[model samples]
Target: MIHLLYLLALLLCVAPLIPGLLGVVLPAASWLPPLGLNSPSAVAWQQLLSWPGLGESIALSLFTGLGSTLLALLFTFFILRRYWDTPQWRRLENTLSPMLALPHVAFAIGFALLFAPTGWFFRLLAASGLNTDNAINVVQDPYGIGLLIVLAIKETPFLLLMSIGVLQQLQVKRLLAVSTSLGCTHHESWHKVILPLWLPKMRLPLLAVAAYGLSVVDIALFLGPQRPSTFAIQVWHWFNEPDLQLLPRAAAGALLLLAITLSVLLGLRGLEWLLVRGTRAWQLNGPTASTYCGLVSTSHAVNGRYNGAGSPQTLHPALITRLRGCATALRRRIPLFAPFVLIPLLVIPTLLVWSFAQRWRFPDLLPSRYSFRFWEQELEPLLTLTGHSMLLALGSGLIALVLTIGCLEYKQRYHRAIPYWILAIPLVTPQLSLLFGIQVATYWVPGQHFGLWVFWSHLFFVFPYLYLSLEGAWRSYDVRLDQCSRSLGKTAWQTWWQVKRPIVQPAILMGLAVGISVSLAQYLPTQMLGAGRISTITTEAVALASGQDRRVMAIYGLLQGLLPLLFFGLAVFINRRTSRYSSPYSSQGHGPSDTSSTHSGSHHANDTVRG
Candidate 1:
């Protein structure tokens, strides 16, 4: 039965890639028989190469993709270095949940609201009597500066979350003690010892971020440039064009995108290789190296002579003055975190305010008038779209949860597991590239199953996330419970149901919530597979965001964010309740430590899920 279920899981999740790939490759080679281009040729590639702004579009994709990834990595490391293991670290961890829960699309909308030319920032400047006519352009800037910053800021928390597991495995305190004992300053310890160890483990998450930045369409549409958009956008445009003959060019563009994504991933891997193996000079440098010691001495001087508290007897006045200066500098620098956390909190209210505003002109702090008439007008369609979105999310989330459990069970029983790279493929690969092929494969089916296609496509994407989310739970779960149940004459299924299920239930629910968010955020899959026949909140929200209807956009954006937020809230509730119930079960193998393992494992499993 386990073997049969394993086969079924593979069929549901892994088998579809074949047709999806063929759907694009065949078309790219100009061999789509249905479209009447039977013979294979390079015409599509030629047209793609000859297209106007092709080079610029590719450059934009590379720049934003690689640039955002690098920035997010640096920011994540900096935050970890400054706050990890400190009293303030717990607050940073708490901050990550909301920021991580906020979907990229919703965040993009809010980002635009705050930074667009006539957005809140400029409005503030205008109110302050500054000349706002020459306001800096952020939304749709040619260089994709807005998109880069948004992606970096949004992805940093995710990297930090991923780092939790890696840092745990590294025995961070031990490493810090060892390094600092060797006369390395705290800063030098992180940069030299901790960073080298962390980077390699971070390879998968980094690739995920880079690939996402490259292929993201919805977020890019919200804030990316329009004239010569990113390469993914260019391909999306071609794919959506009315001309059927241009399908091959779109397919070719997809192929080009796949190549670029793969190349970037390989480049990242190579860079990791160089950092870890090829170049040891930087890693071998001493803590007291001339380059960093001067800076490190004044700042991370906790190890030199003064402990965390600068007591009079143990400290020199000169050292105390330097410490004071460092403390002030650090205090000034740490508020940088305020913008990342506060801006999103501010955006939520902005979205709420905009949704009800009757007329809110630029440079005005408050809406001149507010009414619910826009909500009244949008109520019916909004309900319908919300229904579709919710149904899709629930259906996909549940199914993916089931498949994940089965796969994990199979692995446990058989003492084998699916390769990490296979599981990671769905994440690191560009969704736009994969969906084009998947959409083509869907067309070969008989009738109009637009909703079914959307559900299945969502399931395909959601499976990996669910699997990754539950991986840590399954791994850390004490199989002794299973053995104890089995020894009492229960069947394997009975044991799993009676003994194993409850323990991992929290992780499962959280996985379901993650799956729902992923499904809810999907835009290209629904649009392509549904053939515009189905309209969910995301599709509607993205479409409306392009127009001048701020109220409607706000309504959908908030609704879009609200659905996932509710699920995450439920997951948290269930997890907390389960922890409370199982508090007495610590001696029986259920404990708070186990719960932490589950959450950490889930986070670790999908290190690249968000970014």
Candidate 2:
């Protein structure tokens, strides 16, 4: 059974990439058959490169994708430097999960609602008589600025949460103590110590961020700059052209996107090397370096802090500088969760009302009259689709859970684990890019196991999150109790069942919840691999959204958001109710040994404590 699951896991999680990659590659090279034209040609590449707006699209994607990622990184690091272990840190940390929970697409829609030209922001501006016509343009701005900002804000929580592990690893508290003892000012120490430590660890997550920025279709469609659109958008439009002869063009565009992802990734790698491993020069040259220069140079560093202390004690040289960084970071923390959490709330209700209202118009706020008439009409069809969706989500999630557990067990047994880079492949690559090949490989099988194909694809994409969620839990689980069990003559499996599972139950539940939610939210894999036959709430919602109908779009959008939100909530509820397993605010598995044992003073990996 164990080996079977491992094989199934490879089928579900690892194998899909084969075809998904080929699907994109073959066409991108301009050799496709479904639409005819078996012979490959560079015509597709020619057409792709010659598109009038292709240049613009590529540029927009680069700026927005790279721009938003860098912004999120800076914002994440700066915020942590301020609140990490302080009293203010607790409040900030509390905001992370909800912020992380809001899905990208739902957040985009809500962002458009709140900030579009005619959105709530303008509505308020008009009401205030504050040059409403000249109100700040936010949604769908040509530069994708609004899209990037919304994405960044939406992403801040994720970056912040990812940092929780890094901060814990960095031994932030002790690092601060050590630096302060050396006469390093708090702000300077933060810029020097925390950032340097966090950036390297952040590489994979940041790569995931960069890839999402580059390939995001749904969010960009809703809010990205469209005058030229981004490369991802162009590839999407090309793929949707419905012309078999033009398949190569679409393929070439996919190839272009793939190339762009690689380039940007390489660029980030280059940037990392420059910032970290590449040079020790700048770091050694910073003011903090003076501390290492001994007592005399410390005097010089002292003067850097006090141009003139006591201006306001807010002008207290060292005090004020530290406060400034912390206070600014602290401010971002409070409202961080509010908009992130509340937007999902708004989307759920609005979409629910929308799905039911037949002729509901805008500007009136609430639906004038409500009816389940649409539900009555669509229920049977929607139910079948929902059945398909549920089966896939549940199946993929459980399979993912088993594989995740196996990998975890493997690590515990051998202290060897899959490299994070390998695990993050699905997260870091474009889903469309990855699935392009897998989709073809599926067709290669010459069978009608579309449901199985789709289920496996969903599992492929979702396992990382499930695995990540459980990794910390498994690590933090106490081994001493298991040893006791062994001493009492219980076998390993028995030990895991009776002792290990209970303590880490919350993490398991949380991992399951996350896995299920990710499965529920899959769009690209389902649509592409299912060949338009399988319709989940996401594919349906996305399709309906394309119609641009306020009422109908909102309706589908709500269902799309609700399905995962429901699962995510249940997971959280179970996790919380199963308290004593782990604290809600607690990082995964923080055994005291984490701090005292390996890498003491290393707040860079806060999760070690969670263990």
Candidate 3:
């Protein structure tokens, strides 16, 4: 039964990639029967190369994609280094859910409201009688800097969440203790010891971030440069063109996107290898030696305490020591959490105010006048779109959750697991690349199974996220509980239900929330597969984004962001209730220490589930 279920899971999740890729490959080669282009040719590639601003588009994609991933990575490392085992970690963890729940589209919308040329910031400045004409352009800037910033801020939470599991597996406390015994400060320890281990384990998450940054259509549509947009946006435009003869160019662009994504992933992996594996000197050099050398050579030079001959001179030793102490304290006290928490707080209210503002002009801290006319106008269509969005999200989330459980169970029993690359394919491959191919394959079917195809596509994307979310919980679970239940004359199913399910229920709920959010945020699958028939909140939000009506756009963006938060809230509520009921059983034979550990494990898993 487990074998069959495992096979079914694979069929649903992994098997679809073949047709998806074939769909793109054939079209790119100009083998479209509908277009009467049966023979393969290089005409599409030629056209793609000749397209104006092609180089700029590709450069934008690379710049934003790589740049965002790098920034997010550094920000995550800074947070972890400062607060990983500190009292602030718990508070940081609690804030992650809402941050993670905010869909990228909605975030992009709110970001524009705050940072655009005539946005709230400049308005506030204008109100203070300051010149606002020279305000730096952020939204839709020519350099793609705005897109890079949004992606970096949005992706940092995901990397931090992924780091939780990696840090746990590393037994960070023990590593820190060992390093401290060797006279290494926490700062040096993080760079020399923890970072190496963290990067290798974080390879998959980094690749996922990079891929999303490169192929993201919805967020890029709102915040990305317009004159020559990101590569993915260009491909999106090509696909939407009415001329059927240009289909091959779109397909070729997608193929190129896939190629670029793969190349970047490989490049990242190679860099990881060089940093962690190839360079042993940096990892092996004694922390004290490196620190002493760095401080004496640079710090003393800056302080004018070292002569040109590299000899130390007596120059206010007491003052220098005091200054060093102050610097260390200042570094440790840096407010790393400010931006992460503050941005979302600001964004939510901005969207809310925009949705109701009837007459809001520049340089005003608050709206001049507010009304509910926009909401009243959008109420009916909003309901219809919300219904469709919820249906797809819930259906996909539930199915993906079940399949994820089965796959994890199969791995536990057989001591075999699906290859990481197979799972990462759905994540690290460009969505446009895969969806283009998958959309072509859909035409082979007898009728327009648009809804089915869209749902399946959601499941396809959602499965990977659910799997990654649950993986940590499954790894951390004490299988001994199952053994104890089996020895008590319980069958395998009974043991799983009676013993294992309650312990991991919180993780399961959280994973479901994550899956739903992922499904809710999907724009390409719904747009391409649904053939414009299925208008979910995401599709409608993206569609409304191109218009001049900020009121209507806010309504959609608010709904888009709210749906995911609602699911997350629901999951958290259920998790708490289930935890209460199962507390007795969960604490059995496990004293306060073990109980605390179990709770922490579950909490970590919950934090890990976001997209």
Highest TM-score: which candidate?
1
Off by over 4 Å in 2: 33-39, 285-385, 414-416, 478-480, 581-611
Winner on TM-score between 2 and 3 is 3
Once superposed on the true structure, which residue ranges of model 3 sit more than 4 Å away at CA?
Answer: 288-290, 293-334, 583-611
State which candidate, 1 or 3, has the greater TM-score: 1
For model 2 the TM-score comes to: 0.83
Candidate 1 C-alpha lDDT tens digits along 50-116: 9999999999999998999989998888888987877667666666666777788888887888787
Supply candidate 2's per-residue lDDT for 348: 56
lDDT of 3 at 405: 91
Residue 443 displacement in candidate 2 (angstroms): 2.5
How would the candidate models be sorted by lDDT, starting from the highest? Answer: 3, 1, 2
Q: Give the TM-score of candidate 3.
A: 0.91
Displacement of residue 564 (Cα, Å) in model 3 is 1.1
lDDT tens digits by residue: candidate 3, 238-283: 9999998999999999999999989988898898888788877876
> What's the alpha carbon RMSD for model 1?
5.0
- lDDT for each residue of candidate 2 in 1-611, tens digit (9 for 90 to 100): 55555556666666656667778788777666765767877788888778898778988999899999998887776677666676655655654554455566666665666666655556556666667666668776888898788777777667776776766667888888877776677786786666678788888778888998989887777688777888888887777777667767877777778889989999998998787766566555556545456655554454344336533211356765786678687777664345544654565555565566665343444457877776676668677767887888899888788897887777776687767766778888887677776765665576698788788788887787777777766766667877899999999889887777666665666567677777877888888878888888677766765546655566556665666657656755654455545433243433422221111011122243354
lDDT, candidate 1, equals 0.80
